[model samples]
Target: MKLKHYIITSLVLAVNLSALAQSGLQKKADNLFNKFAFVNAANVYKELISKNDNADYATRQLADCYAFMRNPDEAVIYYKTVVQQANVPTEYYYKYAQALRGIKDYKESRVWLKRFKDAGGDINDSKFLKDADFINTIFNAKPQYTLKDVKFNSKYSDFAAYEKDGNVYFASSRDEGVLKTHNYGWNNEPFLDIYVKAETDTVVSTKSKIKGDINTVFHEGPLTISKDGKTLYFSRNNFNKQVLGKSNEGITNLKIYKATLIDNKWKNIEEVSFNSDDYSVSHPALSNDDSKLYFTSDMSGGLGGTDIYYVDIKNDGSYGTPQNLGNVINTNKNESFPFINNEGSFFFASDGHPGLGLLDIFGTVSDNNKIVSVINFGIPVNSSKDDFSFFMSEDGLSGYFASNRDGGVGSDDIYAYDRTPQLKIEGTITDAKTNKPIANATVTLLDSNNNQIATLQTDNNGHYEINIDRDTDYYVNTKKEDFLDKIIPVTSKGVEKSVTSINANISINPNTNKVTPITELQPIYFDFNKYDIRRDSTVELDQIVSLMKTTYPNMVIKIESHTDARGTVDYNNELSEERAKATYDYLINKGINPARITSYKGFGEQKLTNQCNGTVPCTEEQHQLNRRTQFIVIRMQ
Candidate 1:
């Protein structure tokens, strides 16, 4: 009986020791996670789960580690396990949905997103829930930038490329001997340090660590320099004056520091006043005028995991209170790395908005300094992996960004990109005499040098569309059997929008002997609220005068003018009348006798060519189509 009691007691003692061992392991893993050492934390959590000790907690931590590392494939594996369990946090459902999106499993992502909302997640903060076609929209968007790999990327993580003067400054985890002792626990890589590629250097080996007292034994980099190169702002671990600051939880946070340039070397390092030891503040950027400083932070009262913030830089060099960028530029997920180009366009990184995958870069549409909407910097600028840290030049034509996508030299590499606006020419082909749609008409596009760029046959509806290069002049030639060829000149210059649409309708004359007299000409357009003839409008109006006075000497025509669906209907009617009279006067002054003119009237917004009848939203191009004058022949001899 005593032997049986002894065996039971020994078994209980064994169980207690095993439980204690697991508790210790959990603490160690949690500590590493708090320090952003996700790789090491994941391994420890995996070991704990292997023993089936504290399995639920270990599994959740393992999922979180992968999620933070931007490894959505692995994250989904473990998140799937934890989310199915009873009493799981509501946030897990949202995280799983995001991971599913990262893998392009959008159907399943929506299902989980709905579940997340049903389980008490805030639907207002969910972008996917608001737009049902968000994924398709992103996939179908025309790429706006051409990306190319830089020659200096290393096998280790390298990113945040900033150009100043003739040098390219960036942050890298590449090994610098002796400083190798400062290896980071996060990815088992050497701590990131500021490095520069001199303008005179032609090879990657010529790049070297920056000369300054800025770098430390801890992580330091991802910096921004002033326009004059006299000041610098950079991110670093919470270490200063040989002292490392830690939060109450013993986690080290990042802080933004300022340095002055003295005799070509960075000196006089000082922390920004807004920094706190409790939360991180990093990724500094300056406005074009240097009147404001932008940064990323998680200090307090933010709407997301991290958010973009800004502070006004007074003329005396003092900073105003830091202000959150608000809901338009932030989300419940992370938003970081704020940059402003010379044109005042705001750019940043976000995983919260709809994107191709993890941490895609986004831009803002600001109206008088207030962000009204956001736009994703679609594929090539974004990939199915982490992409962030976008920086553009003063011209807003070319720039750099960082990505950890496939076919790269390292985990994170800087890529150069040139911005290209999407330009297109589309219209219909019709017979000049009958005004009937002509099907299967051959349309050939030629560049300024008369070289054929593309050729295609119009569809059954007589509609043809083709892409064209930006800021180039092109000629569109339309031809068909028994029809005279028509060549129209189109130029894409001084186009300010990202998408330029040119409508080039072509009317071909029939080659048969029984031909109808030419009566129709290109519509004449007017500037907003103006009735005076423009230089371009004279081209179309002269065609009208020629047809009436010369081509068909007895041609009788009626002029009709219309206005876009804006302002009061009465005002539009009055404006259209003035436009119609302007067209009538121009033809008469150009030697067309008044006897050939039958009538002139304004249609206002009644005869719209498209579906932009005021209630429906329309682009500027669509509105421009309605503000025009057209001439119809009542009788042509």
Candidate 2:
């Protein structure tokens, strides 16, 4: 008996020793890898593996090191060993499949993918299966290289790569970042300029700068060109000898500047005065049509930190007073550098997230003033450091942004990428009766066969846009509680080079041409703060699914639920997300394809046609209508 006890104790000590060794080696590898020493980390991981051939952790680390070093060929071998080792964690299966996909092995990738799904994997992480890089790699037979490094700076020179119409433009710390440097003694860059990179990528304004803009002086950096490359908008600040002024940083105060090309020569360059002396603003982003401007500012009465705001460019060229984008887009954390792609997607950088670092590039899709999918651009675009101020070309196949990670020339140098956003539709809501804009109206965008895609509310001006992809046809339905609902068509033909304004009117008639009339569209309302399928909501979604299933029995519907501006932004967002997902999940279970179903977006307080929350008394019925279920057709084969 004593001999047996000795053997058991001896075995335990061996296991402990092995574990301690593995832990120490892992710590070393992690530290080395974190310090950008990928080769050293790979070596250490290999040493550990050589010591313990059965060490699954060591094997996985080795694979990660190889992948990080852009040696997917080696990573594939290690990852395959781990995957076939069997009984690996489900997450590991995904990693293994991803490695397989990395090596242009989709057929093998599918095998592991099946294991991952069978083992309960998250299918919605589309970056793995749907990212442009992955698509380009698989279909085009190229390598999908993840971001190996990021470097941040006060200025990003890579904006030149994102130039419009063959013009050269970039974000700089030159003499013209802001109108004037205030308390921070920073204003437009006195020396900094959006130095147009010459044919050889030099900061040669002669080739880079527009004739009119070249003379403005002050700092002219961080500039973004219009989608078609016709309009040039940038931040202006007081400047020093050549450095950008702090004023242009959206601090003490900031202003957005604009210029347009008329007869080939740049004309009319000046500052935008919509920013109040009482408030500070910077980082101007113009929408596809050059009609909407999005910026960031610290003008007190906001959601906190810095919030994103927009002002509609009136017909006469004056901008409407800045309107706060609300709590969803403006987290308590600073939201800066607003960017809108040709596809109408909004991208910005923020520290208010679960990212790989300090500030990561986050994005959302807003149409008529409603945001959908406030998500982090993970892995390839984000890292364990700050990566902000992203810009993509007009075609959107290539993107450029600034980051400070491992690979780059210096702090905040430019990085290029191949990217393309899927298609989506956005618009507004109004009263057919008076044609007056309706605020807090719910806009439910459905697809061709009638399925919920996303649900959002209109802004103070009765505007809302539905977020969808190129593969889907859209129907925008407008509804206000206690008011008749109206559904209109919004088609995205891929050639529309501007932000389309789609309007739907909800009306309840007092009298018909001959006598009293009933109504035009049905208003779907909700109970207090609920996302559960109320009989009313069910009736609506059911009507949609009924129409769709009649066309295709094997139809898949995606129901996106929503809520109004009645609670904390984050909490409201969470509730809204739950509401949308619950609606989608319900319909999916009720004969909708779990795969055919696409997404649920919780717009939170971001989309509000009227400032109703915290106000005296917004009708429960109105709030109910504001709370809604939106359907979009995802796939119709």
**Steric clash count of candidate 2:** 75
Collision count for each candidate, in order = 0, 75
- In model 2, the runs with Cα more than 4 Å from the true position are 1-161, 173-191, 198-207, 214-217, 226-230, 238-252, 262-267, 365-369, 419-637
lDDT tens digits, residue span 230-321, model 2: 67676655332344445333442445667787776656766676754445566777887888888877777887777789999889978888
Q: Which residue pairs clash within candidate 1?
A: none
How much is the lDDT of residue 204 in candidate 2?
A: 45
lDDT, model 1: 0.74
